[model samples]
Target chain A: MSVHVAPLKTYIYVFLALMFFTVLTVGVAFVNFAHHAPKGIGNVLNDAVAMSIALTKAVLVVAFFMHVKGSTKITPVVIWGTLIFMVILFVFTGADYLTRPMTTFVPVMSQ
Target chain B: MSENSTLAHHFDSYAQQKESASLGMWVFISQEIMFFGGLFLAYTIYRWRFPEAFAYSSNELDIGLGLFNTIVLIGSSLTMALAVRNAALGEKNGTVRNLILTMLLGSVFLVVKGFEYAHKWQHHLIPGPNFQFSGPDPVHAQLFFVLYFSMTGLHALHMIVGLGILAWLTAQAAKGRFTPENHNYVEGVGLYWHFVDIIWIFLFPLLYLFGRHHLT
Candidate 1:
């Protein structure tokens, strides 16, 4: 197999992009979308935005820096499989927690 | 069948050996993702349960330090990538220089983290019998600190280990151990370094920037 040595320019470009996203995330954090949106939705939106940017950065690093973009077929398979399981873990656990009655487990300190 | 000295007898060619090494590293990284995933899950649940407490506690974190460290870590990732590039091109000095620079940035991150932890310690936020918080929901706020310390503490530990790897890589590169055809070790370590950076990419926002908008 021929080694695919990525150009230096590619690494620099990805680095710049990661830095830009980092600043954008910090900027987004200071904006209170809650004041503009319905009661609970604002915080959710904030989290969504922050996480989306983080995901973008992660993708950039994984693809270019980690060379997964040019890697063998099994690499993405392993990554996506792990990610799917992670989602399952989150969704099933979240289902239980989010649906539970608030009073079911009150903080002992509050009592 | 392989002519390259670095090629293992068990592998058919250098390429096959390199692919196997890369695959093994990814598998290890997959397990690491799950390991950290559990903490992220706990964080999400607790933050959902105690939004205000978590926000207030998050606000107590110094964003300046967090942002600085984010840049530092990302910068280290860039240097690590460059180190791999140089190693792949069989540039010995370039590889060593970039690896050393990566280690330097990583150490700076740890130093900043040390100061942050010291700040927490001084402010009585270490989350123990002596822990104290003036917030309305000190209990829940303490929970936030518990996650904060554990998550970032674990990340710091990874950085220390990464630095150790970089040190060894630097020494090896200095000795001209890696060549264009046999730099899989450099590439593998670079992947680990970038993975750690990705973890911090998520950690910075979740831990330091969570409730900044609420801080009036």
Candidate 2:
């Protein structure tokens, strides 16, 4: 059987997935898995969860709304061109944040 | 319109014209993503330094409103897509109706968001100048509010612009300007509107709903 798909159906699928994501995000937020998890998990689990959810949503938006899903080579190339520059920017700036030498001022204790 | 003298007399054919317009809009959307990327980066750095405070500040935000707004924007995005589809199918009336719905939905988002901001302002929830909420580390709390406002405020501005485009498109549709062979505006506007929705998708959880348990 030759199966045919409509664009609206695809959009509806995406919309439902987004609704699911909303629940997942809210639920993940209430869970005590992050470093600051309402005094529960002492690790960075919560942060990890939050970041993961965010990344998923970002990917979905880019793939669908931007029409990168089932896209041709030329379009992907254009998107990647911009992404390359963005990545380069993030790299240098992020490295600066992590590598800055911290000097403890420690108010001089005068005898 | 025939391909000989009807392809806008500019492009080789209608298909080429449509593809080029879509490509151009995609490029514009990429730049927008990068624009918001800057704020998200700042938010990450600050969140790392003051995780607890970010969590605290996030909880105070109305998560329900944020979630609801997400739905509204998503629905608008769909309507925008329908506008493009109608334009491609030579359905002038469908295009106008869809554009109106899309634009109205965008306005609803702004109105709802305005109410939220008003509530925040009344509570002195905005960062700086008598930020009333106190409980968590005050400095970190303030950082959260700063990020919240910057992210959401920029989003609201985009919504306003999207409404403008939608309005223009609605007017053009009323004049019967779009048909199967001519819907560049509809396609372009759809791409822009969808991009705005995408930005909010990322911002919603990051700004309004993250780090929940920690605060309560």
Candidate 3:
């Protein structure tokens, strides 16, 4: 019932990859997309790129460093379940605010 | 049973015990994800509502410290993974050495983070009465700092807890409690340490690096 331990070299590679991604993210943050895109679009592009990179790094950490890659079947299911729940939580809550009428708000309480 | 006293009687084999432990840890981690998810959602809401202010406020953060601490955390994760690997190899000294190294690296991260917090205090970045954000919308800037402190503070709390676990594991390693066949505890700790590192991975981009382009 012992888990399959990753080879020591695998751990090293994963660490190096993580470090590389970290530097990459920081480096990419310096790029000025404002030069090529409109202000709002540029900010979105910047955020999208940075976020995509961060998500990739996160996957590396979870799958390799955390040994989720070769873990039991149930482990991945639990992991996916958590991820799905998070997506639902963020999307639903975010959509509510994102789609709201900018002018609509409850009146402030009377002093 | 099987000359390994660590094996619980309920488990049919060492593998069963390890599997059970792994499953339990994953479940716990899932719950932790939800706990932090709420915080992330709050951050998303505020960021959506006040993007410019959030970006401006983020620029005030010490990117140098943030980057350095990011590396420190990644290095700690490596050391943590090594500790578990050493345990799986049944090398008691190796496990102890790596665990100590991991703890030291985690401490370094916290120390740097402490300095960053103090710097924020001196700069009046705290989100209370003394808050002083010099950007266009100081009010919304306060929102940024609120999320920043809350998220990173929670993360630091996890690091402290992880350090405590590493200390305990270090003691166990010194006692020769971990062998290649019975090192689930070490693996469990590795999962936790790596998870903490993952949180920082997202935090680095979301909080520290988000508005850096404007500054440059």
Q: Write the per-residue lDDT of candidate 3 for residues B120-151, one digit (tens) a residue.
A: 99999988777777788787788789889999
For model 1, how does the per-residue alpha-carbon lDDT over B1-216 read when each residue is reduced to its tens digit?
446489888998888888899999999999999999999999999898888899999999999999999999999999999999999888999999999999999999999999999999999998867778897788789889999999999999999999998899899999999988789999999989999999999999999999998863
Clashing residue pairs in all predictions, respectively, total 0, 3, 2
| Candidate 3 interface CA RMSD, Å | 3.6
Q: Which stretches of model 2 miss by more than 4 angstroms?
A: A1-5, A34-44, A61-66, A101-111, B1-6
Per-residue lDDT of candidate 2, residues B1-216 (tens digit): 545443566788766776788898888877887888899888877776667777778878888888788888888887777777677677788889988999888998999999999998998887665777766676568777877888889989999988887888799888887767657787788878877887787788778767676654
Per-residue lDDT for A2 in model 3? Answer: 48
Best by lDDT: 1
Q: Which candidate is the best by TM-score?
A: 1
DockQ winner, 1 or 2: 1
lDDT of 3 by residue, A1-103 (tens): 4446688888888888888988998998998777788766876887898889889988988888777787779998999999999999998988888787554
> What is the Cα-based lDDT of residue A25 in candidate 2?
83
**Residue B166 in candidate 2, Cα distance off native in Å:** 0.3
DockQ of each: 0.66, 0.32, 0.57
Model 1 interface CAPRI class: medium
